[model samples]
Target: MSGLIGKKIGMTSIYSAEGTVAKQIPCTLIQAGPCVVTQVKTTKNDGYEAIQVGFDDKKEKNTPKPLQGHFNKANTTPKRKLVEFQFNKDVELGQEITVGDVFEEGDFVDVVGTSKGKGFQGVVKRHGFHGVGGATHGQHNRQRHPGSIGAASYPARVFKGLKMAGRTGNKRVKIQNLRIVKIYPEQNLILVSGSVPGAKNSYVIIEK
Candidate 1:
């Protein structure tokens, strides 16, 4: 399955074609690009089959020398983002792969992205643990605390992997089998039917 690298352009609600009422869907607006094939890897040469695709134009002053050389080999200008995806066969170097080339409306795809960051949180919000009973009946601020640590004598130490408060979110996540609502090839944009992981303007990878 091949995929495209794109930037999330926020979300919006749009009406269906049947003139139905506006549906408030969690749509992801992505700029699905004029990407250039930077490198082609073959099974014999690289022990795998894949194509390295580059997206978004960058000025020469903003691009590093090493990457400039890389894009030079592809006979394309410097790109801001580059991602490699494994494909069944090698793609031609410098070939432009646009949104129209990869996907169409109603296609099923999985969107991969980094979820928004949430700071340190308690077990109730983090692990969904039922906190202590009540505030009126003797229990006070302890309502949010984890009740017990462990058994008394045997295995006295608190067990490892016990759910605890810590940093949350800001991790790579994938939402699978999302239906494609629309594709705007002229704008190089794709509208997905549901929410995708990550904050607005974050980069996402859409895979078929």
Candidate 2:
């Protein structure tokens, strides 16, 4: 699949007109590139085929020496995000791929990003556990507790992979089949229907 590295600008609602009816559609705003092609891999060269592009600028002094040379080879400045996609099109180094070039209104795409972190959470919030059903019947602070985890003597130890409280979110998530609602080519912005993972200004990948 071909994709572009982008940043999640935020989310908003737009009015979509269907005949005489106006419907409100919630959408996520993403700045979908103006990415520069940094490298192109081929089966004979790198044992596979892919296109590597860089998005967002960074200070040259902050970039490592080897990475600086790599960016220099592509005739581009140091970038904060670098992503590789299996693009079938031929592109030269330093070629810029913008949102308009890859996606259009009404096109469906898949967005990949890191979801917002929730830190350590209980089973009720993390795994949707109902917790203790009643507040009565000696259920004091046991409401949000995980209750019993293991059997008595038959299986003394708790089973692995059981749903339990743990760190939540801050993980890679892919939202598939998100329709492209609109495009602002000059602004390098794309509006995708429905919600996308990640916090505002976080990096995302829009795949077709």
Candidate 3:
């Protein structure tokens, strides 16, 4: 599948045309593309087919020597991000593939990103386990404790793969079938229908 690289731009709510109330979707506004095809690979030349693309400009002084060589080969300025996607063998080098080329309004897309980190958490909040019973029954500060483990004799050790409190979030996640609310080709922006993973300004891959 072909996709585009974009930066998340927070979220906001918008109203629909019908009078019926609907949950305003929180979306990540993305500055999608103006991506330049830096290199095109073919089975005869590289043993496979793919197109290497570059996006977002970077200061010449900030770019390193190794990457500078890459940009020079394409006869373009240094870009902050570079990615490759499989495509037809006929794609040409230096060709520009904008956001408008890949997606359109009402299209279904899958967004891939890293979710927000939540640090260490308790079982009640992490695993959704029921805590201890009432305080009236002599249950002290053990209200949020993991009441019991198992039988004293039959299973002395805790079971493996048991849900427990620990670290959470900050992992790769994919939200599938998100509606493409709008597409602004002039500004290179894509308005998705709901919240996506990752923090603001984070990179996300939008795939069809």
Candidate 4:
């Protein structure tokens, strides 16, 4: 599947010109490629079919030495991010891919990004577990506690993989089948219907 790396600009609402009256729709704006192909992997050489593309600029002093050599071969400046996207078609080295090249209005795409981090959380907020007991009914401070996780003497040890509270979010998430609402080739923007994961300005991959 061919995809482009994009940064989530923000979210906005637009009116749909359907029927007699117009209805407002929520859309997330993204600044998609203008990505340069850095490397190409073939099955015979790399055991896969993928193309590595680089986007965003980084100072030469900030880039690593090995990666500097990699970007040097591509004849492009240091890139902030480089991602390999599996594509069926062949693209030459140093080729540029724009948002208009792979996607258009009315196209359905899957977005992949890291979700927002929520830090440490309780079971109530993490797994939607209700509080242990009510505040009243002779209950003191047992509310919001994960009561009785394991039997006292059944296995003599706490079971593994318990859904206890801990750090949450900040994980890779993919929202599938998001419809492309609009595309602005002039400004290199893509508008997708509904929300995708990750915070604003974070990078996300839109795949077909």
The CA lDDT of each predicted structure is 0.87, 0.92, 0.84, 0.91
Write down the TM-score for model 1.
0.89
Residue 130 of model 1, lDDT score: 86
Best by TM-score: 2
Q: Is candidate 1 or candidate 4 better by TM-score?
A: 4
Stretches of candidate 4 above 4 Å error?
none
Candidate 3 local lDDT, 128-159, one digit each (tens): 87798678767778878877766687668889
Model 1: residue 48 alpha-carbon error in angstroms: 1.1
Clashing pairs counted in every model: 0, 0, 0, 0
Better of 2 and 3 by lDDT: 2
lDDT of 1 by residue, 47-154 (tens): 988899998888988888998899999999998888988776546899998899889899999999999988998888888888977897778788888888789898
Clashes in model 4: which pairs? none
How many pairs of residues in model 3 come into backbone collision?
0
Off by over 4 Å in 2: none
lDDT tens digits, residue span 87-190, model 2? 87678888988887888889999999999999999999999998977889878778888888999898789899999999999999999999998899999999
Model 1 per-residue lDDT at 14? 72
**Colliding residue pairs in candidate 2:** none
Please give, for residues 6-38, the per-residue lDDT of candidate 4 as tens digits: 999999999998889899999999999889999
**Ten-residue stretch with the least lDDT total in model 4:** 148-157
Q: Rank the candidates by TM-score, best first.
A: 2, 4, 1, 3
The residue pairs that clash in candidate 3, if any, are none
What is the model-wide C-alpha lDDT for candidate 3?
0.84
